[model samples]
Target: MDAIFNYLDNMFAHLPKTEEVVRAKNELGQMMEDKYNQLRAEGCSDNEAVGQVISEFGNLSELAEELGISNQYQSASSEDKFVSVTAAEGEAFIEKTKKAANKIGTGIAAILLGVISIIFFSGYAEGTFSPTLGGGEPNKIYIAVGLGLLFILVAFAVYLFVMTGITTEKYEIFEKKMVKLDPHYKLIIQEAKENHRPVLTRKISIGVGLILLAVAALAVSGILSEDNEALLISLVCVLLATVGVSVWLFLSGGMIQSAYDKLLNEGDYTLERRKSESVVQRWASPYWSLVVVVYLAWSFITADWSKSWIIWPISGVSFGLISTIIHAATSSKQ
Candidate 1:
């Protein structure tokens, strides 16, 4: 009976580790064991009984089809074959990439807007624009800063609205209980690693290089230019270039990472990892929203735009700490 079960395990090892397949394997083993025992009781030798039991059981291909595990097996019939799991994983990966692009765009936009607002209001305070408006009167400066803050808040709200739907959709895929990969999955993964990884690495390198070059150019332009208007134009060009490279990197790099996850049966969708991730996801958005509110209120009350930028890095660190604490507490309770 142990030998029969071991043979069955070896036979079906190529299939994904799903619940239905596991149940079918157990039932089949029991049936085979009973048949083997019946043959032995009929005065058959040990070898004869084993042979008879296996022969009577018939071919595994037909049984695999009945059990819905035929998808992993190669067959002459095309209709019986289902789509590859990797294909679905690919679509999910693309969605994740789009979500990442949105996140990056939102963050970059906010940072750029913050810097622009500071520069504009600071100049307005010193009468750099429109000398006729009382030469940087405190009242005028206040109005300019107020308008800038309003723009920033509006941008943030729009970002949240647009990205919430994308984030929710991506999470839906991650929440699913993924089965283990097929035995042959490693072969396909090996091929992908050989063929795709080098290309992806090169593209990422190029993208990063472009961004760095743009930043360096912007820095040099700012340092050399005595004219504020010319420096602003150069900064805008640099920002556009940086954004293009960033989008390219996010799309390409995300797909590569997703491929690795699918092949290795690891990453966010894996059972153990998803449990901790779910807890963090539940609290992250609200925590960040509160942080944003605090940041804006503090900046406005104190009129200290320069120092208020520190809130973002502090909040990021605090969010990680909060996630760790929540995970520990939940794990201990469980």
Candidate 2:
């Protein structure tokens, strides 16, 4: 009996909650219960009686029409319809956007701290700040190391906080099966896609432009005199611009991708797609953290600030190979 109700609950879980739907569910449940009791009284086994009741009651779509509640059911389906976005799903989307924005913002903040740390460390290493302040103080070296370590710790903490807050189960349905949307809802989805196409292109272009501008600013700063106040000022401006563009891209792209996901009922947000990613592919945060640590350690130990930039490109390619190998290994295991 409990199992029977559980099955019914699962069936109706996707539908919107409304007075009409609730009343219809109650009436149907009562009918099924009555029929089950009758079959049991006639000496049918528990399983047989429950099965008989379910078979006689039929599926919701048929029962809804029979009960003259088809219109209500259709309305609920239409109102709540999105390929992957239900009430809970909508909330999850919003939460995910917030998380991504926070991560981008925090990551940029951490990088800015790293830049400041580098300035301090470079000054200490080269005795650049000695004339202005005093003879090379040991505390300057300690401050440089301390700032570098603090940046790593703070960045890691932000990653942990954002990742832990995500509720993976909210997206589990996509792994289990595809959602079937009504024809009317499908048309709505199609319209949304078409309308957003131009906007998507524009947003992507703007995002890329901002990123390139930041890179150009950084490059120019690197070529300038180390003691030039303009170098520090330009770096600060680049950091602020990068952070602003990053946040905008995270939020805007997330919203657009959410609509696309809802339209197709598939994508990275779906469990099926997520499962296809290798464990190494999912360890992006940790991998990049390692890169950061190695970059900092190499620069500090060798005081090779000029050559340290090479580490980024090397690590980038290495990560791709590592992910490919892990993907192959996992695929073979499966």
Which candidate tops TM-score? 2
Task: State the lDDT at 296 in candidate 1.
Answer: 74
Please, what are the lDDT tens digits per residue for candidate 2 over residues 37-96? Answer: 888899999877766665565557776765566886687467653244444554454466
Residue pairs in collision within model 2 = none
Across 28-68, the per-residue lDDT of candidate 1 in tens digits comes to: 88898988898888989866766566556655677666678
- Give the least accurate 10-residue stretch of model 1, judged by summed lDDT: 76-85
Measured on C-alpha atoms, candidate 1 has an lDDT of 0.61
Task: Give the per-residue Cα lDDT of candidate 2 at 328.
Answer: 62
- What lDDT score belongs to each candidate, Candidate 1 first? 0.61, 0.60
Model 1 residue runs over 4 Å out of place are 1-89, 92-107, 123-135, 138-171, 179-264, 324-334
Cα-lDDT of candidate 2: 0.60
Candidate 1 Cα deviation (angstroms), residue 238: 9.7
Model 2 spans > 4 angstroms off: 1-88, 91-104, 114-131, 138-149, 152-160, 167-169, 172-199, 218-244, 247-259, 266-286, 303-334
